[model samples]
Target: ALVYVVAGAGVLAGSGWWPTAALVAAAGGLALKAIWFDPWLSVGVLLDVGVIVAVACTWPASVY
Candidate 1:
């Protein structure tokens, strides 16, 4: 959860490490949801996918 906060802040701040941090956080969140298997977590799955796609699309040629 803290990673998500850090990654989100990084993304907003245009930090060089945001893409990696975001992807890692998204993957970790998705894995956690999968292992827990709660119906309410479906939204989080979609959010994870959104984060992945967003990162892929927005990544720049040079982060810094």
Candidate 2:
């Protein structure tokens, strides 16, 4: 869910630059919502999860 991304981002922000990824994820979710004709929330859901996974995997724990 999009809320998960926001909440996770908030927590991650407390740690470091991870908050930036969260902001990107949130923007991606919003963009999906705006660009999709049907506006299904699932599009944003996938984007948010993908962003979180991508950031988490690539960034080292110490960096965050």
Candidate 3:
């Protein structure tokens, strides 16, 4: 369901690096979408962007 590529275990442990992992995963997702270029994935693109923005906005408290 929710993507946790780089932060699976970190997320489970509530680690501070989880946000960084999420940013990495979201960036990866956007790259994949660009490479594959599927109209069906438009909504996913928006979500990926959202993750990137949200993590960046909260960076101070997220990835310590």
**Highest TM-score among the candidates is held by which one?**
1
Residue 15 miss distance in model 2 (angstroms): 4.8
For candidate 3, lDDT tens digit of each residue in 8-39?
67766878788878888898889999999989
Of the two candidates 1 and 2, the one with more favorable TM-score, higher being better, is 1
CA lDDT, candidate 3, residue 1: 27
Ranking according to TM-score, highest score first: 1, 3, 2
**Which portions of model 1 show Cα errors greater than 4 Å?**
59-64
CA RMSD of each candidate after superposition? 2.9, 7.6, 3.2
Error of 2 at 32 (Å): 1.3
Worst 10 residues of 3 by lDDT: 1-10
Q: Which 10-residue window of candidate 1 scores lowest in summed lDDT?
A: 55-64
Could you tell me the lDDT of residue 51 within candidate 3?
82
TM-score of each: 0.81, 0.38, 0.75
By the lDDT metric, which is better: model 2 or model 3? Answer: 3
Scored against the true structure, residue 40 in model 3 reaches a CA lDDT of 100
Q: Give the best candidate by lDDT.
A: 1
What is the per-residue lDDT of model 1 for residues 12-62, given as tens digits with 9 covering 90 to 100?
787779788888999999999999989999999999999898788884555
**Between the candidate structures 1 and 3, which one is better when assessed by lDDT?**
1
TM-score of 1: 0.81
Task: State the displacement of the C-alpha of residue 44, model 1, in Å, after optimal TM-score superposition.
Answer: 0.6
